[model samples]
Target: MYPTEESDPFCLSAASATRLLTDAPWRRFASMGDSLAAGTGDPSPGYANLGWPDRLAGTLRRVRPDLAYLNAAKIGATTAKTLANQVGPVLEFGPDLIHISCGANDIWRPDPDLAEIGWNLRRIFERAAETGAQLTTFTLGSAFVVPGFPDWHDRVRALNDITRELAATHAAVLVDMWSHPVNSRPNLLSADRVHFSTSGQAVMASELVKGLVDVLRAHPVTSDRAPE
Candidate 1:
């Protein structure tokens, strides 16, 4: 059994039921947000960047052989642009499962606006929820790990707090990246010291899949709509 709210108020429980993915009613998966979702650091020689979302999709494919996946994320995307550009395409895809990761870029900018970031994120979450998809997002790990961004640590924390609040308000799955063991490991980061390395991506995908499975088990879908 998963930990109760009393035991895990942060909702950082690790999922043990791998079979839940097979049983969940997720046929179409869509991803939005920024470069992290775009799979920037984990590059392949021939194929496109296989980021954590792509890795998660591959795992989902194992359970549902016919799953359709679409990633509309781009490198260097801000929360505002993501809210504007990615929402329409995601809604068009009509995915039953969606992942969104953004705002890190905005937080690093000079004179970062926490209120504006929160507003844009709320809009994105609200719009995504309208599609009736099970949405998932994460709190950024400590920005102290990122070289040359020591001053932005507080901003990252603020954004993470907004993300956590929005996740609860919107009933979306939240991955507590701040508490994850990989958060402190420097090797998990790519040369840029911002994005995750291939191994780091794998670790993130592993943890994220667990969260997704937990959400599915708690709120099993009962629809029969096919992927469009």
Candidate 2:
């Protein structure tokens, strides 16, 4: 059941419980998903997209200067396509850490199949796990605030639940955006009211960095080389 406006089921308290990996220097970080992972909303010169992944990569570089980054996220890609196309390159990259943030596009479809979307996501997570990479992901916040999508809150809620469940089952670090108070802020969203603004991306990167820090602290990297 979806929580009411007065209720805060999706709170930051859960994020506090994310067990930290031992402090490790992540060598390679790969991102796979849709525009969110691709960093579409924020444009940069000489770069097609500069979103959260780039931001997170930049932050991670502070500790691991040799960190190799790969982003195979394409605009408009759904979970099924991401599972089919994006996952291969990620596996090929053999990253020590991975981040995925797809399925929002699927939710916007005229008639989305939540069940199939969840299945594809599970496959993607399972396959990524096989590579032995530390994974990170986030859930979507309420979409009711977005204009013309009055009833989308429930759909987004269902999707978020699926994401949370998969993240737990897969032992993936989760940045619970759905519960964050920032989700209710209008300034975080772009003019389109769907994609995040530059500031919003920064905020997301900040949250991801926090999660990554905990993961690194708990699972210290014993090797300086990428996982093979």
Candidate 3:
């Protein structure tokens, strides 16, 4: 009854969602990093089977029927692993738009090295940015908690800070989901209570579309010119 309702958060129809990104110029979209980027989660009652990336691609395809899409995200992938693994394939894909997600797995350990994580992430962003693609990413929601880790909040905050700094430095379109009102919803996460449910995935995709729409408003991308 919640997500199925049009009044619920992120319950946008395909046409309504695509309308917001009518000016989007990206022909090829690729996503890389961790399970969050992979869109792993339990099936939510009122949501589609699609993950955020697929859902996003669907909307993009509506505007550009020839849009090419790739998702190279893996479960349990840390920042270092993402750098070592996914980046090459993503580069090879030669995407015009790239969505990156990581850092959560890096901080899953009891003693995470924030400095190292930042360095790896910076490298990841540098490589992605150098490709001249429109980069997009989102911060983890506050509801994703690791129970045994007493300092979970502190860790997430620190990681979010790093993500924010990188996003600013690279001028990446960012969806700042940290402390978002959606996190308050009881059904936001899956049974694992870690990854987002389909409802959350839908919300993530819609939010990302909105983020791109905002960027297009501030700096419209011309047909001849790539996204700035």
- Flag regions of model 3 displaced more than 4 Å: 222-228
The lDDT-based order of candidates, best leading, equals: 3, 1, 2
Model 1, range 60-161, lDDT digits (tens) per residue? Answer: 776677899999998889999999899899989989888888998898786888889999999999999988888888888762354566666777779889
**How close is every model to the real structure, measured as TM-score?**
0.82, 0.80, 0.94
Q: lDDT per residue, candidate 3, 1-37, as tens digits?
A: 4655245565677888899888889899999999989
Error (Å) of candidate 1 at residue 201 is 0.9
Say which candidate scores most in lDDT. Answer: 3
Alpha-carbon runs more than 4 Å astray in model 1: 1-20, 43-49, 143-150, 220-228
Which of 2 and 3 is the better model by lDDT? 3
Between candidates 1 and 3, the one scoring higher on lDDT is 3
Error of 2 at 137 (Å): 0.1
Give the distance in Å from residue 139's predicted Cα in candidate 2 to where it truly belongs.
Answer: 0.5
Clashes of 2: 15
lDDT of 2: 0.73
State each model's CA lDDT, in order. 0.74, 0.73, 0.89
By TM-score, who's the top model here? Answer: 3
lDDT of 1 at 58: 75
